[model samples]
Target: MKDTSTGASSGEAVREGPDTFKRTALLALGALGIVYGDIGTSPLYALRECFTGPHGIAPTPQNVLGVLSLIFWTLLIIVSVKYLIFVMRADNRGEGGILALMALAMQRQRGQSTPVARPVLITLGIFGAALLYGDGLITPAITVLSAVEGLSVATPVFEPFIVPITLAILTVLFVVQRHGTARIGSLFGPVMCVWFFTLAALGVKELVHNPAVLSALSPVHGVMLLVHNGWHGFLVLGGVFLVVTGCEALYADMGHFGWKPIRWAWFSVVLPSLMLNYLGQGALLLRDASAARNPFYLLAPSWMLYPLVALSAVAGVIASQALISGAFSLTRQAMQLGYSPRMEVVHTSAEEMGQIYLPGINWALMVGVFTLVVTFRSSSALASAYGIAVSTTMVITSIMAYVVARERWGVSRALAIPVAGLFLTVELSLFSANAMKLADGGWFPLLLAVVIFTLMTTWKRGRAILAAKLRASSIPLKELLGSFGDHPPLRVSGTAIFMTGNAEGTPPALLHNLKHNKVLHEQVVLLTILSEDVPHVPGAERVVVEPLEQGFVRVVATYGFMENPSIPDVLKRCREKGLQFQLMGTSFFLGRETLIPTKRPGMAVWREALFSWMSRNARSATAYFRIPPNRVVELGSQVEL
Candidate 1:
């Protein structure tokens, strides 16, 4: 039986079971491509960095087994247990991400025992989301660089071309984003399927010669490595942490392919492939420690090297695509949630709501990726800058998950604390390990996060302050209508829709029209658009229309944070509720604010200037709302803050 509430099926073979199974199998394949790309590509550089990186230890048998043990258990505990089993349960409706989790946790739950304030959780969530942008920038740079670096393994003659080849690949990757991934998205599954199979095949080939390396599966060897190597072994964690760098994508992309598909992909394909591959690399090290320089490439025969390089480059592009798409999604959520200024959002796929492209974000990421490649020049140098942002984000996710469990899920503090504590303990340790690289290159993402966080917070605060100022200066709708009834103005022939931020007040554009033209439309609509803290608002509950005096009507249209509002769509919904609108006869009045930063009490002078700059550059409401540009009447106004 299918559970309508959660949209999950119980284990009974019904008439539709076969179809459901096929659909799920397809989705699981797709998940292998998009969801696992980052972590899946990590095998290229993660193990190599552990033993050969700056903090790499001597490749003793004990150290090899120990590091392999750490990789094995870390995947089980962090990716399988924590993310797949526990954290995915905290999804908002069907959507999952740090922002979605923040919204879910913000919902008021009775008898809640969590001491953290809502604002604190929100700030943390925003910062976490900001950190992902840094990840987005670095993922493309590092993954592509690592993939192209494989050419060097085949022959040192290809060394000179690695950086340029990586740059060209990444440039093509970003340039194609505008065309959409709908067509190529299908190929991702099959390609990644082959990639994973290749990984397993390579590992098994090496494992047959050195099956003894399987002894590392025990936690004892991992413990012994640390016990034996002391501080150096602890430092190796910075490299080990790279294995799970893209684990957050599992939860973040849960909305695209449900947790079930992600989990299936992980267990049935991704997890086993990764384990075998890591062990194979370890076994290769045991046989010949000299292979540590490029263990992943060296695992294959000389004949397979070029083919492997080609596959790795393709896989790297797929991995970069996931992070780029995620950054776009995160930006949209931030915009809808009032934490960001508006950006022009393009719908890439008509059939899929989630497939969107943001040009501003795309170009910004492209530039950031280019800068990193040009500056760092090598994947190993770039690797030092990675892990830190993602690890910090993981720590924040754990904290938010704790609050979500205590409040949203109504789990007792007793149960919630220890589970959250376990993840936190592991994550914090990884974070500290990555922190040691701050002077080396880890500071890049942290600095980037701070800049993004500042912009988000400033935009949010600035909008709130702007609304307050407008509200204080505005006239109430009821009072305005009463005066209009007392002395009616010259009535025009068509409908005039005045968009307002405050639902209860007369819009500034409406007042401006009255003052200048001294006329009113035959019908006037005071329309207010609001964003709810959910992924989707039902169509039946999308619009609310109220008839007011003097041919005036009040309409409130609500959309979810994951949605882009459309004025024409809202009008059509209003028509369903007995309110009529004509395409050519309707006019939209929007207030165009000219912000003047002053020595105000609301914010620092620098922040005010930044907010003003953002506001000035933000996409216009006419474009953002998909309104008819020809029908828009923009009224200019100045506001000092």
Candidate 2:
């Protein structure tokens, strides 16, 4: 019982048939368009940057061989071994991402019911997610710029127009986001298929001229380059790091397409095409050292240069689209987990649950990207800011993965230590090499991560303080129910429901309604919506209803962090539990908090002010939960912390 509209299971199990197989194949094709777009386009600029970049080397026979060997090994160890094989296995109920994996690991610890809590592990994962926002900003700027820069290689006149052309293409790309990708999504797989084939075809054409370049496949050459070149060779790693920038998508997208299809897509199509293209670039450089300035474009025949540039631009947009979608998904998960403020989330596709558009996030990213394009002015300059953010994220994933293996999987520390140690060693080396370029442009992502991390933590901590203050001032449920029975208020004829964060205590709205109106509804429902750490809560376990004294009913609605919360839908579930709903007869009461900052013990005055501002801007619960707007009544209260 798969619910195609929501992408969630409807029953105990998923149906398996020929239809399922076909569906999996289609998803795999789509994954190629979105998941592999960023990494696949690296051939356009990775090799060229290695030779002509700031730390560029001589395009000598030895240098070319060494660089090729490094590229091959990086793809094998980082993408193939670390992520596809090991990390993807640590999914949160078939969902994969650093945050999803973190939830899985935290659940494993909490299952023990121990007194000690692991806050540091949770903090590490949050910081990793924050870094991705920075990466999202840079991916579009660099990938699109690199693709358009290929035009400059054709003629000197096109060089002057490259920036303007890039800006125009990016403007259209971001503008169309509100319309959703479903209409054009079908074309992505086919277009990317052609793009990769062209990449392989160009590589094969050059490799046929000088097949000896294949010798670079051996590890010895890569090692020799580093040993002989010393400091200069070490600096080349900054450029080499570009080849694997999009590796994170492989894991992040596992929820959309299963691990099996992604693995199949990788070994069968993406890996081979990428290797051949890089090898082809190496062969081209060996034949003519001067081609190092733009070896990727040089591999193409004179007649095909313009068409190739056109195709490359499309691929760049596809890459940026995937990053933008991923950001929306991550933000939703964070809000559900109580780490962020509630915001408006619009579902863009009726058939696809994952297709969504966020106005706030979309505008913010557009501003950051356009600023980067104007500031950097060239692809190579923007490259300096790229690797550090992704590299740091990779290292953080490795450490967190080790914790999952040991604590969750019950693997022995002896085995997990060395296995994870190898990954950390390599990733830390890449991070340190990229760190050398901090003053150049690398500071941008780090600074962005710090600002976002502060905001996330502040929202989370502020909510905790607010809840504590409310609980301290509130009366227990039993005490309120007894008082209602003793001094029975005037009875109204309709039903009234009050939503509260704390289910065990009397809601502030309920108390206010009793005090001002001096009357109680014939049927009263105290409802609380609870978000679980898992992905989806089953229908049977979604609602818990209990009978209380004085005609009062307590209802708790549960949802997974990945699922959207809807009051109407939850009420339908309540109907199955023998509770009836009438649109006109039922009235929903909500409590709205106005945060007032003070020099309190909980947080600094400046942070409290920031939290108050965020609270004011967050979406209303009635709108976010999709309750009928006309049927809702809000009561306001001020709280100081």
Q: Provide TM-scores for the models.
A: 0.97, 0.96
Judge candidate 1 at residue 173 and give its lDDT: 98
Worst 10 residues of 2 by lDDT: 1-10
- Candidate 1 global CA lDDT score: 0.88
Per-residue alpha-carbon lDDT of model 1 for 436-483, expressed as tens digits?
989889999999999999999999999998998888878988898888
Model 2, position 559: C-alpha lDDT score = 89
- Give the whole-model CA lDDT for all candidates, comma-separated: 0.88, 0.86
lDDT of 2 by residue, 282-359 (tens): 999999999998898889998999998999999999888888877888888889889889988888888887777778
How good is model 2 by TM-score? 0.96
With a 3 Å backbone cut-off (N, CA, C), the pairs that clash in candidate 1 are none
